[model samples]
Target chain A: MPREDVMATETQLYTPSTAAARRTSGLRLSRRRVIHTSLTYALLLFGSVLLMVPFFWMLSTSLKTLAEVQTWPIVWIPSNAVWENYPAVFQKTPFARYIMNSLVIAIGGIIGTLIGSSLAGFGFARLRFPGRNVLFFLNLTTLMLPAWVVIVPHFMMFSAVGWLDTYLPFIVPAFFGNAFYIFLFRQWFMGVPGELEDAARIDGCSTFRIFAQIFMPLAKPVIATVAIFAFFYYWNDLLYPLVYLQSQMKFPVSLGLRMFQTANAGVVDMPKMMAASMMALLPCVVIFFFAQRLFVQGVVMTGVEK
Target chain B: MALRIRMPKTKMARREAMEGYLFILPWILGFLIFRLGPMLYSLFLSFTDYAARGAPQFIGLENYTYMFTKDPRFLDSLRSTLAFVVGYLPLNLALGLAIALLMNQRVRGITGFRAIYYLPAVTSGVAVAILWQFVFHKQWGILNAILSVFGAQPIGWLVDPKWVMVAFVIMSIWGVGGSMIIYLAGLQSIPTELYESASIDGANGVRKFWHITLPMLTPTIFFVLITGLIAAFQIFESAYIMTGGGPNYATYFFGLNIYFTAFQSLRFAYASTLAWMLFAIIAALTIFVFTTSRRWVFYAGAREDA
Candidate 1:
């Protein structure tokens, strides 16, 4: 039977006369609900449009001629769309190379973060250890420590080791588990039933085997969340790249876009700049749309669920 | 062989501890090398005259003293950062909650709206900052064009000292969709029974929101506030990319100051001092929020009186 039908029948059984009266009032209630819903939609639509103007403006500006971009009454749409601006972005700078550098850093970071964080998280969640609680607390506290606190020394260390102008500074730190991602993994791992581990143990599966074969497979969601977070972090990162990388060839998309802007200096070409910005943003937007559920879940996991 | 002589329970405990350590070994190494070592080295550097060249001279407390007494840029950076936090946080929280409420409504196409809202939050920061530069152009910008429809004159958003921070705050609202998702998650977690029972007690929507929803969401609000405040204090990319700390240094944020001091000027010691100062401010503010959170943050299952 349909669940709604069963619920309706149960409701009718409890109070037949009241149910009939409720039907009449339900019509009025639904009318109010409709009105409320319409008001909500109107407000939401208004806000969404208001919020989306920048993006729309970006797209519009990207396709406009230089003169049209500076026209008095802003042209909503260019009469002749300058689709060439998209290709022009590449002609002007090593944007393709920048995207590749960003990808290398982001992917390398994700791999390291997944390996490091998952191992630590599994250990914390499932193993018995001396000072485990204290250690975990210490790890958590590091999440609040500002990056600036250690950035100077990190730069000095990297420069001393001649890792400057390379992706090493960006990618190498991920091998050390990030406190936030570890926390996420640990939280997810903690929720798995103890019986699964016990069953595996009874079959003589080693702890590492149980973690690798059993827990890791079951942690696809958290893994996805961590990977997405890592991607976002590395992809959007500007400061680290800005501080470490000096060569234009070593620049990530973030620094590359900045270089494009400053390269022109006073004579700003608005359309081409918009086009480059759009290109730089494309991968992130695409990834987000595809993996949005993971993004939302990751954010919620960071909240005070415990 | 030694473990085999011990009690089985103790032996198992020892094995688990060993396994735990093995699993977390990577993290432990990372913590020591990347985090703890750098932090101590940074602290040491802050008290020296290490200017990225031949710097071994220890200048005890001189950097801190100069920062406090003589550096006008330090004060300016602090003023701008505080101004940004003030202008940005409340609006971000309120708008995030408002949009979350709208999204929580049982309306069709709400997911589409949610995605549209979140789209900006996930885009590359450098790209978005560059895009906003065009939007905030004095005369040719879409914002000005729209304002002119109401007969308001064009304002120099990035160029004007008074409006640069306002421009930044306006740009920031585009990313409020991030917090909106978190708020939506918090809203979903609230038990429907609370609202049902409140309806039985003749509570209106506003009363229910005030008496139940707001209190229930305090923990989420607290989380958002802390994270948002930390992020706000780290503002650098937008100011650097869009305005270059601008016309008359209006947008010279602390993060930018730290960057310029360390990288551009090669004043590593002074920059380290600046960074420590930032860390102190962030830590103090975070500690303050955590202390105050006990009064306002509501945990659902925890003892109410406690």
Candidate 2:
């Protein structure tokens, strides 16, 4: 599909035809290419440095002493690395418990999203159903519905049910299938060849069995994309937790970090706060580095499809 | 092509329909319980007067009337949000596209550069805000330190009401990588032959970009602008964490206003009214975008209502 061409710009730009043209043009092309490549490198390098400064500052501040962090000249790097700030993050607050809370929520969210989105996506993509188009359209409309629209009543509903200060509000919704992820999975599922499903159907497989035994097993890539998105969503989510979970014990990392910052309002411990920020930011950065392609693919597919 | 068969729904088809519903049951249940239920409750709540403790009393648009006529904070938040959207959206779109254009060049280690630029996109909003808070500190901030290098006096980023929104705008621009990748995909999708052909027809680089690239990228640009505007209007986390909707409420975005109204003041009914206003605004804007999109957003294939 044209999508493959779009996604793999790396390979497309370095195609053999272009290499052949460069080779045929020889020295002039080589010199021009050298200048062109250098100019590209210079521009990108400057941009990369500018972009990396905040991250670099975060890491630098995380290891600096409080005095050094607040010093006038702005310590680009500390004269001494206070590795104890990382330990101090746990020592001063319930950082470990916050991480645990975030992990439980993120993991729960991922599991629920995968199961719910995959099942619904499979049904929508592969099954013939009355009212399917209407139902799908309704689901798609929810994508444009901002979260704050229902948040007030959602809070009151949860409060009525006495589910406040628990992870229920954050994790439970993920089990119902997100509109965006369902759409993503539906798109992926639609591209799967009909031959496999046909063969499974010929074997007298039940519809659910066809999905489970045939489709779900082959849906690793889309599942990963959904899981990654859900993980980040849950881990970084602050509003729902802030509104629902009032206690420090129930606070996820995002809320925990916010609370920590607020608690130090007047004093402003830059090193410790930054250390906590790095810990909160680490998992997402690591995940993005590992699954950069999937991240890019998800963004591109959503934009194009919409 | 010569023979066409149309089959009416039979017993098998009805059974398939039932199975489809069964598969999608979780989502349906989830939607009812979580999405549709809360939405209806919110609509009802908007017409009532309730603080957390008592049964909501029917107030008949009193909350909405108060918001429109009496509240200063409400108007301030609306103005601030509008200003933020105006400032952030264009910079995000332009910077995202410019960076993407540079990244599109055939350079070695381009992925590394992309990764660096995208790092902020993955970081939690709370964490990013905390980091930027340090960077925007009145004294000893790296930004001020850099200004010192150029013999320019330090300007308060978060301290001054005039600059706090600008600081938030800068932070939003830092995450432009998200849109940049989408633009990159759009650029990649445009066949290189279009450029080759244009060049052959005596089009220079500037003319080619104006005639070919921008027009071809209209759909993507439209997507970015719509989503960016929606996201900008809903600005919450950074304002909540960094500014706390202050330096005299300069960064008090609409989302933060709803949040504070509901959670902090416990005015569920008023918050509901505010939430509905946001919903209506978003819905109207989305409809506007869709209506206006036909004028400029070019599609190479079958078009769908955005």
Candidate 3:
């Protein structure tokens, strides 16, 4: 009933008890458990193969030389690994600069989203005000407005304000709490017991202090989740960079990779593009490995199925 | 007794109001400047035939009329996009759900299984497109090589217009991790007692799942369906990056068409109208789902709001 979202911070849902319950059930293993487990394992394996097949080929293709890649009787593994492809990506395009730009945008976006959403969420969940629901819904409606419709206007507004061709247009708006993030944090805040706040108030905490101390401390899991989601968002996003930025130095990995693909068009060095893709995928995977539990928790809490 | 209007001190209420706004100031400002301004401007842009060079001359209804009456390409694209959405949305969601259900049962190295299924999602859409492009490149690709082992013929992937959309669909299936993860979360939240009770009453695995899991998880499935439908309808990146809406425009999606009209062609007015059409279709579908969700979308742990 609450915090349903998409293109979002689903990782904000990890509360300890529910996630723990999922991991450590009180029941003992039995015949039914064994049978069910085996059946599920078969299903999981089948699905995993389906999901992994494309990726497997991608990696294998990346190791093959151009001639090898386009040869008859395509080889899954190259007789000779084309390790040079990775280096070629850097030599061929502004990939390093793109990576740097992505890192900056993602970090800026994440920090801005987390701090701004937390503050706004605290206001909505813990503080009372008129027109809150109406205003919140208004914010949510904007989510339905296709991003394309807003592009020209955003471009005009940014150019008018002289923030074009920089990360300012991409990153600045995120400092305002996004609708979904605020909704997510609001839901979590509502569930925090009121007594903790009362006690904090008695001990002379300001509303802001209570937020930073009481709510935020209880929000580490969520904060971590938002950090990961926001990181992935700005890092991989393509359209915004394509529209707002023109300089090669300003390209994120998404748009930069596009340039690589375009430049290599028709004479595509498959290995090079695949290598760049793998490189782009690395940070997100690494973060997911560490934050998988929190990520699942965020999904559960937000109920962000769609 | 007279009903006394309990008037609170104006200062406290005023301060609370100010603080609420202050807390939400970041979001409000962004919504107005970043979101609202663009949204309104785009609506206005949709009507005029603004040739990119000068002031938008009022060409009321012309763009919309052209799309319906004269533009055969628009109709072709609409059919292609809608068919693509219809085909992909159901297929991917089903695959994702089935996998999630399987993974819900306790299995060895479940987390690793999760990571594997989720691999493509981490790689991002562009990477998926690049990888898949080479995999299905017909004569020179690994896919046909694998098929040849089973004595199957080579199939043109990106080049052939007929199989182009299918290629996109097949490629899209690789990233089921996003929805699958949500389904897993939905599974985690099912009060185990429901399953226990069902089994105790002689429900087998299938029955227990049907009676318990399916009902309990309907809300999530519904959410996924609506969002998936919306997302599928607007799929742009893979088609854009992989096919360039090409091979006779077999996969030129409406979203891409709109983008081309607005950005590439700089037909801002025509692009605006196209965007409006997109907005209308998506909005209509969202409302339809919301209204019909009453028949399904069960909430566990609490009653649905009246």
Q: Can you tell me which runs of candidate 1 are displaced by over 4 Å?
A: A1-27, A304-306, B1-9
Worst 10 residues of 1 chain A by lDDT: A1-10
Per-prediction TM-score to the true structure, in the order listed: 0.94, 0.92, 0.89
Tens-digit lDDT string for candidate 3 (A101-198):
98999888998899889888888887767777777778667766677667777777787789889899877888888877887788888889999998
Q: How many pairs of residues collide in each model?
A: 0, 0, 5
Give candidate 3's whole-model lDDT: 0.79
DockQ measured for candidate 1: 0.57
Better of 1 and 2 by lDDT: 1
| Rank by TM-score (best first) | 1, 2, 3
DockQ for each model = 0.57, 0.53, 0.48
Which candidate gets the maximum lDDT versus the true structure?
A: 1
Q: Among these predicted structures, which one has the highest DockQ?
A: 1
In candidate 2, what are the lDDT values of residues A61-179, reduced to their tens digit? 89998788767778888999999999999989999999999999899888988889998998889888867878898888887778988887788778888998888877788888998
Predicted structure 1, TM vs. truth: 0.94
Flag the better candidate by lDDT, 2 or 3: 2
Tens digits of lDDT, candidate 3, B1-306:
233433346886766667877898888888878787777787888788785777877778888889899997788678888878877888877888888877776667989998888767666756666777777777777677877999987888889888887888777777778788888888887788887788668888788878888888898888678768777777888888888788887887888888788778888778778877888888898889889988887766566678
In Å, residue B83's CA in model 3 sits off its true spot by 1.1
Order by DockQ, highest first: 1, 2, 3
Error of 3 at A104 (Å): 1.6
**Top of the candidates by TM-score:** 1
